[model samples]
Target chain A: MITLETIRTAHDRIRAHIHRTPILTNQTINELSGVHIFFKPENFQKIGAFKARGGLNAILQLSEQERYHGRTMGPVTTHSSGNHAQAVAFAARQVGIKAYIVMPRTAPQVKKDAVKGYGAEIIECEPTLEAREAGVREVIERTGAVLVHPFDDDRVIAGQATAAKELIEDADYDSFFDAILAPVGGGGLLSGTALSTHYLSPRTKVFAGEPEGAADAVLSFKSGKVEKAPYINSLADGLLTSLSERTLGYIREHVTDILTVSDAEISAAMRLVWERMKIVIEPSSAVPLAALFKNKAQFTGQKVGIILTGGNTDLGKLPF
Target chain B: MITLETIRTAHDRIRAHIHRTPILTNQTINELSGVHIFFKPENFQKIGAFKARGGLNAILQLSEQERYHGRTMGPVTTHSSGNHAQAVAFAARQVGIKAYIVMPRTAPQVKKDAVKGYGAEIIECEPTLEAREAGVREVIERTGAVLVHPFDDDRVIAGQATAAKELIEDADYDSFFDAILAPVGGGGLLSGTALSTHYLSPRTKVFAGEPEGAADAVLSFKSGKVEKAPYINSLADGLLTSLSERTLGYIREHVTDILTVSDAEISAAMRLVWERMKIVIEPSSAVPLAALFKNKAQFTGQKVGIILTGGNTDLGKLPF
Candidate 1:
């Protein structure tokens, strides 16, 4: 039910809380790919990801009844071991609210520390989606907190759309872009991008870049139904999640196509971005670039926009 | 004499050719150091350094008589194993001129390849400053090319000043910076930065950041004369060169002080920039930040500008 107006409202509401990340262009990359590319570096955003927009928008939109119970502000709860956990925690603290983040025990220490650093109370759970969800439910039941599902919520999707909205509006690309590409995870960024592009620049096609190892979005697009990968083995750890039905609905209606890229291609693209652009981008962010380069024939001689999802990576564990 | 007018002219001449590199800020670094830090990321510039501005300015400012010898365009020659070689080559190629770069045979293959990639012919020399100068002299004598000294030349220094000019003009700081710090090698960036700050933001004090292992700049500043390190041992390879007399003259006139940081501190600062700023900066660029952090007491509660000199690094040979 998220519309252009909803996304616009979210953008306006969260505008002050987030960074209007820079859109950078590289001549070498443009010449190599045979396409003019505008890269929206969300890694520079607050909390180091596009998720900040969604989390902030979602938190700021809470009604008085939802935010407060008596004199105390009610807690917000989420189950994520990824950027969303830190995003929600950061946004919650910004609004003077407590956050209960349910994370798996197997999650990286850096992510856990980041979430904790934001003044969020962590509820450790077993390394499974069901266990994580149950942990979140338990925290909510005990604390009377509202649950903000990462990608399933309409408000979150509307928040994510602001990244694309800003990209389309701010980039001084001559006229409109021929296409826009975003990596597909739980489909939050991809679906949000699809909606924004559909409303803002109807002529521009929205493409979803998914990892070949976790090709649920691609499979779902082909089968015309929600699908899950049997075994995910991509180096893009942020893209291992299956798409929610809500995200799939938006993708089916608005996204032009779902493209897949291998882990090797993702690593190569990541290295190129680091070496050429002098910007740090995670493997997930490189997926879109990998797909764009792999399908250069389809996008030759056209202006393209690529959303670099995030830049949270272990420098010690670089893929290269 | 290099004046503010000279720097301004360089800015105007090279404005169209080089990137107006972005000035970025980080809340984490500000909080950590107790100083408001404005980072002028010249690392993102063409040739991945501020040298591009100087190289482009020097080449473009060449007189028709100097640029051409009858029907044939005169070649430009320089001896550099660092970012300057690529900068001169890139600038030369942009103006339809040939570049002769002299480098030690022991220079990184990647550095040599980058110069060659820009259509510049590389003249391999022995790994000594004497050999480098002799090789450059040979190239100039053979081809009747003009020698563009990296930092000592007034035109190149003026070009380097443009980075600080843009930084002073573009940064959204509420007021002029209290102080500015730039890493010193042959003193091109530091002296240029001092001149720019002296002219533009007269209230701002300029400091030179140098590696402890290559503390010639500090020694020279104290002695009021040019000084050279007995043996350079810092990880910041770019700051190993001794300051030229032309550059030292400016440093003594305008620079507030010369501060030195250790290689360990440089590595730590570089890691922090990568992790927090989400930008790739070479070890040389980290010297300023390390110096700033070490002497936080001096700059406490003050607004400081740190020029990140370059981002050209061998990815496989990361210090971290």
Candidate 2:
């Protein structure tokens, strides 16, 4: 079970390897929202996402006995077409271990190139959840590599919580935030953020922001059980995954509420950040801001903290 | 006359009003160039440019006697269609003074709207230098307002110098930088930067980065006299202006050399910043990086400082 202490330990483990990303604030955004908003820009984090922390923490926690059975050690394996692929590759390389990534054939060339840049071997599979799982299994069977589930693992969840731990402790705000918001992408960031805020600032409520098109977290929260969307289609590509049982348990226990925002709202918020803050943020990162903007009354005259999940964007295919 | 002391005073005066912009570094970029690079991102400033410092300093420096002749105080007038217009407007509003901006009708609507949003009245003119001057003269005649020249004024130069002052002091480097680079337009930023480096770190050299299409500053530096470009056409719209006499004097004395980069190089640098640093910067702001990349031999193992002049970009009209 992951607790506040586990998160703290993970924070200590990954402190030296990751960057302490800046807390950005904009006067215009503050005025418009009628609230003091502090943004934890993880876009500036190493590997261009908060995934770096989790990946590094998980890799470092692996015991030598578990890594190697005989004189030879096995490679780490994962199935991802996004930032996690690069993160795992980077973490494995840092720990002197080879990484084997299973990616969909339909994934963008940029994503493939980024994972390859981190010195990871890629194995392409059909664009389906079962196909990805089969590809990972095949790689593990051939190379005896261990599979690192993206957001479902306890170690990864604890590591992801460090971002919020830093946000709560490092941000130069008075006392604590009234509310902390994070995008719900397979419930890694939101669950981690909820746990951190629960431990660090008990008075602060944790909120989950999900794209309306892929509102699996919202449905699960309302239904009081693990739920999946029938059809997922959002510009926020990072947020299309359904929450795992482990992540859903944390969300049910800690998250105050789940908010949903449209793709248009997401794009508008992204544009505002680009224009006003002069920082590049992916569509997924903008969901929290869009949620806050849409539901302004709940946070009026309050202090809010937002986690900007990542900045790995395809410039040639900008939505704006 | 502008001096280091004047720049220090400007820094003190505008310290609270403007952002103490952060210095960013990228490991990939450092490895690529074989130099430690510090980027002072003024694109994240109040008016999205370093002009905010100059405009605010100039307005705040104006005495009541100079501002008010009879019972009525005169408005601040300037002829600009870019960041300066917004800067003057924002600064005037902050100081509780009226601003009269004479902009060419051919200027982008977005630029005009931004000035108006800052509570400045816009006076439209024909798309010519002579027409712009006439429009400003007319505004001065009608309101008896003080003319705030964008770059020629000593106060503006002093204010612009504060950016370099903060860069030299705030950046996390062991010793002083080997060189400081800034894009030269009317030579306001370059001159100010040169003066600041000259006073703070005497060992550091100041270099001006200019677009080859608008290579007047390079010609002027080489010829040891003020020179003008026969024609100006560059993607960096902020770099089309020629250096004024007041700015030219500082450049001739303090600047080590002037380097020119092509428009393609500027775009590449801008794209790199967007991809690597996750920061938005204008084409002109990218000129310094392009120049440094081209002239890498001069700064192979040295520390370098680059000023990102502005981030006010039109999303719909992206060059990429």
Candidate 3:
């Protein structure tokens, strides 16, 4: 069972590798939303996302146990085409281990370059789930490398929980937040947030913001089971993945509610942060604030905490 | 005389109004540049620029003496088509006084709207310095409003000095930087930075960065008088203005050297900051870094301090 202690242990394991990203607030945002908002900006995190924490925690544990497929030292493998891939690559390099990333051939050249820049090997596969899985299996079969599941594993969930833990610990003067929000993709971040908020600030309500175009988490939250979205197209490319059994179980028990916003709202919120706060944040990072703006009456006068997920965006393809 | 004490007093005065902008350092940027760089990001300041400090300090003095142009409470005025207009407007509103901003009629509606959003009245003039001066004179004569010169005034210079004052005071572990750099436009920020570095970190060398297309300050520094650029067309719009006699005097006395960089260099440096630091800095803010990169031989391995001046940019028009 992943308890508060497990999250604490994970944070301790990855403390040196990850950035202690600052909690940022702008007064203009407060006045506009009729709520005080604290943003935990993981856009400044290593690998430019919160995935760094999970990736580091998992890889470091692999090194610590000396149980690397019964070898003295071994390589690790993961199948991701986004921040997760970069995170695994960056973390593997940190521990002097090799990382083999199985990425879709359809992925952007920039994404592939980022992984390669971190000194990781890339295995190209067709842009299909079956092909990706087969590619990962081939790497594991050939090299006896451990597969670091992106969000489905207990270690990854525990690592993601530390962001919320830090927010609750860093809240104003011993006062807990009234609510905490995180955007739900595969539910790793949201479940981790729920666990931390439930353990640390028990009174605080936990909410997940999901993209309406890729609204699987909301449907799954209602159905009490993992489900796929009816459609999967959104500018928030980071929040397009489906939930796993482990993450869904945590969400069913702990999360208060899940809200959905459109791509337009996400873009507006992203632009506002860029204009007012003078920081570069990805569209997925803006989903929580979009939800807050969409439902201001419920959160009036309340202090809300949001995890701004990442800042890796193609400069040439800006939304606004 | 604008001594270090004057700057210290200005900081204390505007401390409540402006943000004590944080100093940021990225290890990746350090490794890439081969210099330990500390960035004082005034892009996060009130009104999204360091102009807030000088504007507030100047206007706050008007409130302190109950001496508003020999009246109980009189309006304040300034003529600017840039951040200075917003700064004066914001500061006037802070003290519960009226502000009349004389701006070029051809100025962007967004800039005009920002001043209006802060509750300042706008007086539009033709796109000529003479017309701007005339508009300010008309407002002053009609309403007994005192003029707040953008950078040439002692009070404004003293206020601008506080950015470097904070940087020097916030340096790592009782030590100061080996060198400091600021971009020179009208020379408000550069002269002020030089003063602060000269007073607080006497061993530190002060340098100014100028856009090659609008290279006035460099000529002014060598000529020992205010000089105009041979031509003015650059992506660094904030730095197209020429220096004043007062600013030139300070630069000649305190600034060690003035280096110039092309528009291409400025754009490259700006993109790097946005990518690596995840901060939205305008083209002018990148000039100092561009200068550093252009002349890395002199600053290799030295701990360098840079003032990231502002973050106001037109989203529709990006250099990169």
Candidate 4:
């Protein structure tokens, strides 16, 4: 279980380095959905996603020797095709280190260029889990670099929790929310949010929203175990991670429900937010909103808070 | 000419009512353009545009007679097909008045829906300047509504000046910017920015960026006079106004240049911002960026500020 003290320490460490992203109130979405909607807009954060929180925390938590000796000359390895790769690269650059990102060859050029722009090296591989692991290992061995897992790590989970901590402190408004929805992937963010909300605002129910194409978290929550997703086909690249053991355990204890949204619903909700609220959010960010809209019976007239986890979609090639 | 004191008073009048939108830095654009780019992200402003500033200021400056005598119960009229229509509608709602928006029948459904969502009455007109004026007059006669000119009024210009005022106040980092670039329509925001910047930071140059297709301001600047737009042809709907006499006079005295960009450049800049910065901005917001990028030699290594005027694009049918 994560402690408030650890999360609070992480918050302090990354405070100056990361953006205290705004929690925007959407009157339009509220009127449209009939639920009081508060969006924790992480898109405004540095590196354009909430992944900055975790990466910054992990990098700052390293020992002096690790910071000086490991990062100075060699590279840091990460396997991601989304915001995490950019976050790690950004964090590494801030810490005076190079990053070696292992991405599939078919990854968006936008993401690839972003990683390169941060002075990071890239090693593109086949679009398979096995190839990704192999590419990461090769970079780790060749460069003698540190491996920063996107999620499935304690520090990363603690870092992701800080977003929730800020929300509870700044946006919870002293009113006990009926529910708080967070999208779950490898479960780092959701688990961290669950732990923080359970400890700080136990009266508010914590729910994990997932895409139907990436419903490992839902299955894991139902069976009281960790579930492995052999492959993910959702447009939401962020929520494709299977449940990590630590994250799953925390979710089992703290989260109230695990709901799923279809790809079509996510796309529709993404369009609704862009058309109505005028905010550019990726499909993954719309999962929680989609869940709220699809399961309106559960959240009717409820003070529901949602983490719009990311907005990193390339507008030129939006799925919509 | 507008004064700093008037702008400050406008700020105070709507201090709690409006959002002090965040300033976003674009690394991708900075790298590409070789100039440090700072975006005054009014895209995040209430009503999803900086028009909120002018609308709120205009309403707040209304005389007591306007507020009482049940005149406030009647609708407020504005001739606009863009952010101003929504801004006036939102401001009217805040002041407990109905808004009668006169928009072209060819206005985007998204903008129409925005006005409708604010509880405003929409009066559609033929897509012509003469037809629009006639439609607005008809609505005004029918409802006895107050006319909130989008950008031509003194109150609107004073209100729009606050964006530059806030930017100058928010960061006084000891380095004077070479110039401040903003799009010009009726020149409310551009002229107001020039006034405030001239008074506050005399050394900083203020430039009006307009689309080549709607270069009335450019022609006005060249001729040292106000000029009417030949016809509405730019994709940037918010930058399609004829230069007002007051605005043209102010720009003639204070603004250093009036630059123009092609429609393709505007669209490209819009796409770049949406992809790299992960912020949704309308075509009008990208005009200055387009101007800066298209004419890079003019701003090389110079600290530049661009007002990202709004984020009202419909994601379902983005022009790209």
Candidate chain B TM-scores, in order:
0.96, 0.96, 0.97, 0.93
Interface RMSD value for candidate 2, one decimal? 0.6
Please list the Cα RMSD from the true structure of every candidate, rounded to 1 decimal place: 1.9, 2.0, 1.6, 3.1
> Could you estimate the TM-score for every candidate?
0.97, 0.97, 0.98, 0.90
lDDT of 1 by residue, A1-320 (tens): 88788999899899988998878899899999999999999999998889998888888888444546544567899999999999999999988999999999999999999999999999999999999989988998899999888898888999999999999998664338999999998998888999999888888999988899999999887787888886789999999998888999999999999899999999999999998999988899999999999999999999899999999998999989
DockQ of 4: 0.55
* Best candidate (score: lDDT): 3
- In candidate 4, which residue pairs get closer than 3 Å at backbone N, Cα or C atoms, i.e. clash? none
Which number leads on TM-score? 3
Compared with the true structure, what per-residue lDDT tens digits does model 3 show for residues B15-105?
9998889899998889889999999999999999999988988999878877645657689999999999999999999999999999999
Q: Which stretches of candidate 1 lie over 4 Å from their true place?
A: A63-72, A172-175, B64-72, B171-175
Residues B218-254, candidate 1: write the lDDT tens digits.
8888898888885799999999999988999999999
Off by over 4 Å in 3: A67-71, A173-175, B67-71, B173-175
Model 1 reaches what TM-score against the true structure? 0.97
Candidate 1, DockQ to 2 decimals?
Answer: 0.83
Looking at model 1 chain B, report the run of 10 residues with the lowest lDDT sum. Answer: B63-72
Q: Which 10-residue span in candidate 2 chain B carries the lowest summed lDDT?
A: B63-72
lDDT of 3 by residue, A1-320 (tens): 89888999999999999889889999989999999999999999988899998888888887888865665668999999899999999999999999999999999998999899999999999999899999999999999889998899888888889999888888864446999999999988888899988888888999999999999999998998889999999999899999998899999999989999999999999999998999999899999999999999999999999999999988778898
Each candidate's interface RMSD:
0.6, 0.6, 0.7, 2.2
